[model samples]
Structures are given as C-alpha cells and as structure tokens.
Target chain A: MTEGFDRIVAAVAGMEEAARSFSDECRIVFLRNITIEGIDTLLTRNLYAERIRPIVQFGGYGTMVQDVLAADGAAGSDADLIVLALSVDELDASYGSPGWTSHAASAQLEGLFELLASRTRATIAVHSFIGPLWSEQGLIVAAEDRDLTSQTAALNRLVVEAVRRHSPRFVLMDWERYLRRLGAESALDPRGHYLWRAPFKRAFLEVWAQQLARVVCALRGRAKKVLVLDCDNTLWGGVIGEDGLDGIQLDRHQYPGRAFFDFQTTIRQLAARGVLIALCSKNNEAEALDVIDHHPACQLRRADLAAWRINWNDKASNLSALAAELNLGLDSFVFVDDSALECELIRQLLPQVTVMQVPRKLHELPPLLLRDGLFDTLSVTGEDSRRTRLYQDQRQREQLRSAVHSIEDYLRSLETVARIHRADNGEVPRIAQLTQKTNQFNLTTRRYSEQDIRAFIADEDVEVFSLTARDRFDSLGLVGVLVVFIEGTEARVDSFLLSCRALGRRLELAMIARCLAKLREQRGIEISRAEYLPTARNAQVADFWPSVGFSVTGTADGGTRYMRLIDGHAGGTPTFVTIEDD
Target chain B: MTTPAIEGRFFRILSSLLQVPLEQLGHDTSRKSCQAWDSLKHMHLVLALEEEFGIEFDDAEIADLNSAAALLDAVSRKVSA
Candidate 1:
C-alpha cells in the first residue's frame, strides 16, 4: 500500500479501544448485496472527532428489502441509522439487455423506502449506484441504444426523486462522486468481487466510509457554523502595512495575486451560504479596511464579514471576543491563517476551534479549503443564507441601543412585534435548525431533528409553537420555538429557546405568556412546568424560568425545575411589545 | 529490500490488520491459532499484503497462505524477483 493508506490503516486500527469509551452511541446497520468487512473500524475512526461512537452491524446480504421489513419487528428496530449499500449489477442482470425494463425494480425500491420511513425512526442513507465500469455493447452501440450507461443514469435520477420525498431524514449518498474521485478502474476490485461478494477495493472503502461519516455528523448537528480568516498573506498577497494598498499583490490577472483573488471568491461564496466570516489580523485596522474597501481585486469587502478584529491583540483572545460578540461557542469555529505561529498558537490555546494553516503553495489554497467537509450540512435553510444580513441588522439595533436612554425607551422606540403561531409543515426545517444551533438562551437545551419535530406536530398530546419577531428595523424570521407535552391538564415544556439574535428584546417573556394563554384556551392545560438544564454555554439562562414567572418546584444537581399555575393575568406580554397570532 | 526488512514490513501489516501485538504474531500464528483470523480477516490480510508488496496472489496461492511464515516467504520471493 501507499504510505498514506498505510497511515490511515494504522490510525483506524488504534481506534477500536477509543471508540468504546464514548458515552453516546450512534448505531448503524448496513444492508447490502456485498460483503463490507472492517467498515465499523473505519467509521469509528471518522466519527471519533465528534465524540460519538458508532456501533455498526450488517443485515443479511442480498436481503435489503427483507432486512428493512424485519427491522419493524423487535429485532433491528433499535438502529439509529440504516445504510443501503446496494449495486445495480447485483440487483438486475438484465439491466442492459434489449428489452430490459426498470418498472419492477423501481417499484420494489419505492416500497422498501416506504417501509423504512413508516416502520423505522432511524435516519436512512442510501448509496446511489455508480454506473458500470464498462458498457456491455461497446462504446458506439451503448451510446446509440441507450444501454447500461443511460439506463443507470435514469435509475439514479429516480433514486434522487424518491429520496427527496423524505428529505432531511432520508439522504442520498452520492457514490458516483467517490468513483470519480478515485478513478473507476482502480476502485473496482475484480478479484475481491469474484472471490467474495465485496466489489470495492480497500482504498475506495476507506474514503467512502469517511464520506458516510461526514453525512452522519452533519445530520447530528456537528457541522462547523463559522469560518474565521486571517488577513495578511492569507486573504491577499502581502502585508497591508508594509506593502501599502497599491503595492500589495491582489489582482485577478497576475500569478500570485490571481490565486489570492480566487481564494477570496471562494470565501465569499462560503459567506453567501450562511457561514459567518470574521477577520483576525495583526495589522493596523485603518490600513486593512482601506485595502478591503478600495482594492479592485478584493472580492471580500468589509460588509461581507460578520465580525472582525484587525488589531495587534493575540488571536486567541480575539477569537474569544469574537465568540462573545457573536454569542457562539468556540467549538463552532474554523480558523484559517497563513502564519504558522498564529495557527499553532490557536491550536494550542483554543483547542476547540478547527485550525488550518494556509499551504505554502498558493495555488492549492482554494481546493484544499473545500474538501475537509467541515461545513457540510444536510439542508441549508433560508435563515442560513440571510445570516450575514441578520448580523448586520443586529449591528443596526446596537446603534439604536446607544442612542436611546433606557432599556424601556429602546424597546418602545423599536416597536418590536412578536407573532406566535402553531408550527406548520413549512416551518419544520427552520424550527429544527434553531433547536440544533441555538445554545445561549435555550432553557432546556434539548436538540431535535426535523423528523422529530414533525412527529411532535402530528401528536395530539404535544404542541409546537414558533415565534417570529419584527420591529421597525428588520424581521428575524422564525427566531423562537417552544414545544410542550401535555398530560391530564399538566403541561410540560420540552424545549423553550430563542436564537441569540433575538435574546435582548424581552421576547422570551412574551413567548411564554402567549404559550400559557394558548394552552389554557386550546388544550386545557392548567399547570405548566419547565426546566433549566445547565450546559457549559447556556449558563446565562440559569434563572430564565423564574424571570418568566415560573416558581421553582424542584432542584437537582445544577438543574432546576419550575412550575406555574395558569391564571388569566400572570406574566402578561411586555408593555412595549405587541403579540399577535399569525 | 533485504529479507529482514521484508519480514518486518509483512509482520507490521499483519499485526495491524489483525489487531494483534507484534510480539504475539510469530511463526506459530495461523488461522486456527488466532481467533480473530477468520475467513473475512484472511481476505483483508491478503489484500493488504498484495498492496504492500506490490504483488498478486492467485486463488490457490492465497489458500496456501495459512501461517505468518508462509505469507512472509511469498512476499519475500515476490519482492526480490
């Protein structure tokens, strides 16, 4: 084996003991037509970074349908995720024949997905079939007759459409991408395929397992949310202070400057996709700002950044300050810098952040940045694309804050309006995103998936309420979510959270009052109980329940439970804010 | 490569793939002696050895590779030739 593959195998071999020590387990079951041995170790190595241990099992081979059907019974129902590692060659031998049809195969696959969706709560990731390595009818005949190549393409399209029916829970694992990355000729192991049922070589299996682990990590809300960048030599070609604005190389047509320009363009695209970009540079603030604003080749302007620190302060402290300003944990950050010293300092001091040192070869910068799957997400919501705008709007609110005299004056002048309504099908994705990403102002700190929220919306004993806040400045779309479970006139708040952007507006109190009123009027819930489960990052909300007029009923190790009796006038909406039903 | 170097590389790859200690995997280690060396693990060992030594073993030769000594001899012969 090559040295790289040898190192990977060595690393995976050492993960067997480490994988067993994780407290939380992500169980996965693979149902395939081929043998895939030693995959569990590879998956464990990939997921070890997230502190989630994976327990992998193989359902019987060539029994993909039967395995899923049996999972609804008591045997395989405990799986947290299911992977369908199937190939078209094993499924249909007559695929490229004269009159071969896809009707029966498509119907069977559809039925299998339906059974999985209805009977199981596990997340399903099915591999898309990579087309055959060679056409059976040769090049010209295959192209003319629309043989295996075209037929497989059509079947893949069908799989994509089918998976879209149950998105965010059922995802398509694009095996074709892996095949392209590793050429098709070397990816297939003919000896292994003939000796055993396994079709892929060891090298292909290693990378494929890592890709699958990336999808699993993204689904579990472990994807990084922020990208912190360095300015000197990282964003542009030279130091802004020494080289000056006109002297620095940042052109679109030149050699070294062109590479930096392309890198900045990629960073801009990342910002547009909802990654909050921040600049941490040791240069003078005025010089860097002038260069960013006036340079013709600067693709990332000052407005593109959500936050920046262009001072001489140490970057570890600056990153902490940025986290405080953005109201995020240090774990959600991916910091990139060109200086080896700065990257190493951040790696040692702020070990929570993923740090990347810019490669010495300038041309390799952009592609290397995109491959790590650090920012992978299953579905990007509208709120994500509008994230930079939301931060900018927060800055506007802060400006308004400084102009006003008192807190009450600021609230009254802003004229904040909060709309509380029962969540519908369209709001499921945003609600799930909030539960996964919000940490600072969350009362219970319970994370949920879109599938879990949908289940709650359909249950008669549970209610999911979403809050959207708007004022004179801008609209924060779907900023809050409250989920309550009711049992015999007693309502239990399962989750109560507001996005960090909506925290200082006294909207949480408004949401609680409206929730109590609605539960009393619609669901006949008389007494409401809520809990404050303190996490490392959510200590700011320790007294949130009492602040919202819920008296403490019980207390455990650092966790407080509060209960409130529903009267008509208790904890009314704040005087400055208006509450309405949407 | 010399005979000692080839043997060292073979044992290292074998020990890693089988999850056994290098000292524990000597000439006596075989499919029957080690419980982890099942049919599935045997296939993994063959694949790893083939890729490491840049050699291919036919079906009959793979079946004869039952012990560490036999596997090292096969790799040494192939690597020297």
Candidate 2:
C-alpha cells in the first residue's frame, strides 16, 4: 500500500479505537468557536497511528476565548498542544451583516493571540480564518464599498502577524490555503452543517487530519532528513550513459527538458532546507560526474550531495552504503527512483526507507514530489538553510585530510577553532535539531523538540551549551550541543550530541574539555555525571564517555552511567584547537 | 427493475463500502439489517455509490436512501434517465 493509503487506514482504525479507549501518547485540547466534531475522529486516528496517542478535550461550542481563559487559570494543565480552530464568522460577529468591516476583527484576533500567548506554555496551533465562498453581498462584495474579500484577507494577514509575534510557541495552520487546495464546495457540506452542526465534510476532515499529523510529527522531531535520488530518467529526461551529455534533456527551454529542470529546481529547494540529497544511480561514475559538473542546466552539483553511489550495483546496496557513509539511519532516507523494479527492490530490501516511484509522465513528476508533504517542518532553523554549505565544507575537509600525512598534523594544519557558548534564544532551534538528527555521535539518543530545548534554557537548574566549529574551510554552525542539569556542586549531563559532519576532528573532545573548564570556573561544580544510551544507530558513541575520562558509575535502563571529577581534571583546550567562550 | 449486470456491479460497490459480503446483502437489506449502517457510514455509502455509478442524488433522495432496495431503485432511475 502507498504511505498515504496506509496512513488513511491507520487513521480510520485509530478513530474507531479511540472512540472506545483513551490515548496515552498526546493530550490535545481543541478550543474552537465553531462545530468541529467531524475532525475529532480523523485527527485522533491519524495521530494515534503515528504513535502519538491523542486525547482531545473540546471546549463548549462558541466559547473558544472563554475556554482558553479557563485553561490558562487551571493549575497543572496536562495538554501538550492547544488547537484554536477559529472561523472568520466567529472573528467578525458582523460577518454576514451589511455593516461588516475588518477593523474590529483584526483587533479582536490580535487581542486573542496576545491572551493565548500569555496564558499558555503549550504549543498553540491557530487555524487561519477561511472566508465563506457564497457571500450575501454577492458580486458587489468585490467592490471597495462592500469588500468582505479584502477585509477577510486583512484578517488572515493579522493572524500571520500574531504568529510572528509569538513564534516557535505559536504555529498557524493555514486552513484558508488548505480549503483553496481542496476546493470550498467539497470541504464544506452545508446540509451536513445545518443538520448536525458539522463544520467540515468527512472527506475534508480526513485530509486535514493527515496534514495535522505531519505538522505534529515535525514538531516532535520525527521528520525525514534525507532524500536519496535516482539519476537516470528521474533527474533528467534520458539516461546519461545512453544519451550523451549534450543529448540529455535537462534544459530550461525545451519541453521534457523544462520538466526535468523544474524537478531539479524542486530538489535543490529541498536541499536548501537541510534535506540531505544523495545520488544512487547505475551509471558510469565519470560520465555522471561530467554531466553534473559541466551541465549548464543542472541546478544540483556535486557539492549539494552528501554522498553518491554511481556504479553498476543494486540500488538497495548503494543506499545502504550511502546511509553508512553519511552516518544516518535507513529510516531517515526517502528513495525516489524512476524504475518501478528499482523502487520495488529497495522497498523490499530496505523496508524502513520510504520509497517513491517517479511518475510516468514527465510533467507529473514535480507535482508528485511536492504533493506528499513528506519533508514538512514546523520552522526552518539556521542549521537547515546552512546545511548544503556545511556538507560542502565537510567534503572540502575530507579532501584536505586525504592529502595530509597524519591525523594530528591535518587537524593542526586546518587551525580548527571551537566557539562554545550557552545556547541563546537564536541557537535553540539548531540545538533541538542536533538533538533530533545527530544519532551517530550522540552520547544519549534523546530527541528533544524546540519547545523542550526552550524549557531547558528557561530552567535555572539546566545549562545548555552549543559548540560551533570553524576550520580553514568553513564555519560549521552549531555542530554540537551539551545540555547539563546542575545540582549543588554536581552536574548531570542530560544530552551530549555532535553532528556527524563535524566528527573525527576531535571536536567532541574539545567540546567536553571546554565545557568542563567553564564548569570548573563556576567553583561549585565538583563532579560531572554522564550517561551513554545505546540505540540502534548510536553505537558509534557507546564508548565516548569512557574515552573522555568519565569513570563508569553504573548501568541502568539499557544504558551505562559515568561520573568524572571536574575540580582536579586539569585539561586546557587541546593544543591544536582554540576555544572562544561567549 | 434493474438488469442483472447493473445489479451485480451495484452489489459489489455496496459490499466494498459497507464491508459486508455480497451474498449477505440482498435487495431487501436495509440500514436496519446492517449494524455498520450508521449515519456516517450511510453518508459514505451515498458518496461511494454516487462516484461508482456516476450519478448525483438530491437531498430528498439521499435522505430516503436507507435500504439496499431504495438505493438500487434510485440508482436505476438516475442511470436510466
């Protein structure tokens, strides 16, 4: 079954199961001023299937503001997420009236958002107001005098402003855009709404639930990070081996070539957003490299890819090798191939990796890639935008390493500098992303959300440190994170993770030593406690703590615990590396 | 009366939507006979039937379509028309 179909079935089954039982995974409270009963089953079911147990608590009808106020005052609110499902009509009481203006509506929305921001620490998702299609004012509504369309557009803009004002905590679910995509008539059943007070049709609810599930997954740090592409007809119109470099259809001017150009452009955009792109093509290595390097129409270059497997081998084995080279799991990869047989082979061999078959028609390929929303994320962090450059820098560093005689000499020659600082507001997202994506070099494979990282920063007992590395090549932005929970004269490390791209340069050791030196300056830190949590992908860092002079304390919960004395451990920053504290 | 070919295809669609065996669903079978024929499933049945037969039902026809016989009759009239 297709992933979408499987999710739908799981959602349907989850809805049926949720009606009979409660979810333990997530507690989501829905505060809406409209009838949104139709969405409960669909949302709960999809989230449940994703292992996010959803327990929905609905506010009384048309009492969203009042319900939020109550939730704010209530002690120990257990909700992890609060969904504000607001409608345009609810925002503007004069919605259908002839005297409608967006002035009051905008003010009211801003006030509501302000109240929501102040009252709740839970992740808030506010649904953007979608205006009704059939207006009583009719075609005259388009006129400036009776302009409901312009007024509604202004209200939507106000919602975006509010989201910006309360960012990382508040997210806007663009229901207006969603309705436009699904078509208003199909999304809303007026008869059903009037008969049973159902605001959305069942079909609309199903799709909305799926979209919401993706958003939730993104929030929970479970988004796929890699896109493994096949290069034959997948990237271009014809095979590079059969069709000469000039004959390949990848130009922006021609018919099929334009389609391929558009596809490559989309792939580049995804790469810019930190989706690691790798090539698994069955072609002559030199020929493929020549096409990528010299092609005028090629948007993706060798620098854009983290790894490539261009050889006459099975794609499944190539994908495994790519995963190993990149130090990422098979689960984090999405395989896109034009051949159905190749797609099937990888799907069977590497069941964990998501496999997508390229469309038969060249024109359909771009839309097919964009439609699934597989790489949907809540917010784009600095790390995301800088990922392509970082990978390119790593490739350059690899080349530098190959030419040097010894590892120590190469490290010294690079003049690598480590800048260690207490993670500030701007660095929280990158820190959270590192905790989520950095599996190989992570001491403890504990995935944390941006919200969780923010909480850690706010807590007086917790200290979160982020380390950024700069060699002769490039500045590796926020490559390592160390979160410690401080107590009286003793600190326990909650998380210690470094990005794999910055591994093997002794940066992990530098990070630890600098963190320890800084802790020693505090005068009260006598000992540092750390743990090594073994996950399927984090085996590389199992002996990391012991290597760094942390004595083995004990074993518990499928992990080994360690403690190191901080007061007497005399360690200056490594002779080769320089540390800048901020 | 519907032809045997149309009836057979109609039964198959109904069976798929209702999740019931074709042998169990007859012309006389109604919402009362099938436990899964709740309001939600009923709406889904209407949508599925409309798409399967390439016909649209009015609000009145939809409300009255509570049984297999009624659905078949409504579909037959719409298809014939």
Interface RMSD of each: 2.6, 5.9
Model 1 per-residue lDDT tens digits across residues A1-582:
354344456886577687678766788888887888767667777888678888788877678777767636322777888888876767776666675656566776787788888878888887778776776666566544367667777778888987788887788878888889888776777778888777887667877788778787886777888899998888998987788777788887897998898899888878877889988999766567766766778889867888888788999999999898888899999999998999999999999999999899988887656777788777778899988877877766775754544456546655689999999999999999999999999988888999999999999999999999897557988999999999899999999999998988899889999989989988788899989999989999998888778899898767888998998865757898999885
Query: Which candidate should be chosen as best, given TM-score against the real structure?
Result: 1
Q: What's the DockQ for every one of the candidates?
A: 0.18, 0.06
Instruction: State which docking tier applies to candidate 1.
Output: incorrect
User: Would you estimate the TM-scores of all the predictions?
Assistant: 0.68, 0.61
Error of 2 at B76 (Å): 8.7
Residue A560: error of model 1 in Å? Answer: 69
**Model 2: what is its DockQ?**
0.06
Every candidate's lDDT: 0.82, 0.78
